[model samples]
Target: MESRFAEPSVLILVSLASGPKHGYALIKDIEEVAGATLGPGTLYGALSRLEQRGLIEALPAEERRRPYRITAAGAEAVQAYLEHVRQVAAVGLRRLGAAHA
Candidate 1:
């Protein structure tokens, strides 16, 4: 199946791939990587969707913070999305020339 990757989903998947993390940590990581803060409602909404899709699963809780890990399917989806983005960037870069001069 084609990846259901949107901006938030892709970002969340990438964040989880590094290792399992709690919701707050994931939000911080994504914001740090993106150099901007993502809204709490938007982040939790995407997390719910990702969990519902079976791309991520909740880990045993510690101190009321629920951690999550990327499922195998999530890895595949994120990889495919990244590859597609790379290809698009490559095409755009290749088209850059002295046209602005």
Candidate 2:
């Protein structure tokens, strides 16, 4: 199966790129950032996959809350994805041709 990033995962990584955050913190931040709620299973699954892929790392455990940070690869991937989104938007806007509307 081809590995693909869910939108929530991408958003989570971008949020963490700024700094480390614990699980609930990440969930709250992402919900605010994306205006969507991520279920517990989905959130944990994404975090596990991201860590396994080396795109993120868990910090030392502090109680039940373990913080995570975005790896260098994660930052690069997020940047590239954002750039691609911008390019795609430009193409779409150009195709619309404001004069026609």
User: Number of the top candidate by lDDT?
Assistant: 1
Poorly placed runs, candidate 1 (over 4 Å): 1-6
* Predicted candidate 2 versus true structure: per-residue lDDT over 1-101, tens digit per residue: 54234487787887897799988998898777766677888888999999999999999988988999999998998899889988988988888887578
How high is the CA lDDT of each candidate model?
Answer: 0.86, 0.85
The number of the candidate with the highest TM-score is 1
Residue lDDT tens for model 1, 8-40: 888899999999999889889987876545688
Backbone clashes in model 2, listed as residue pairs: none
Query: Candidate 2, residue 52: CA error in Å?
Result: 0.9
Residue ranges of candidate 2 with Cα displaced over 4 Å: 1-6, 97-100
Clash pairs, model 1 backbone? none
Query: TM-scores of all models?
Result: 0.87, 0.85
Worst 10 residues of 2 by lDDT: 1-10
lDDT of 2: 0.85
For residue 43, what is the lDDT in candidate 2?
A: 85
Backbone atom clashes (below 3 Å) for every candidate: 0, 0
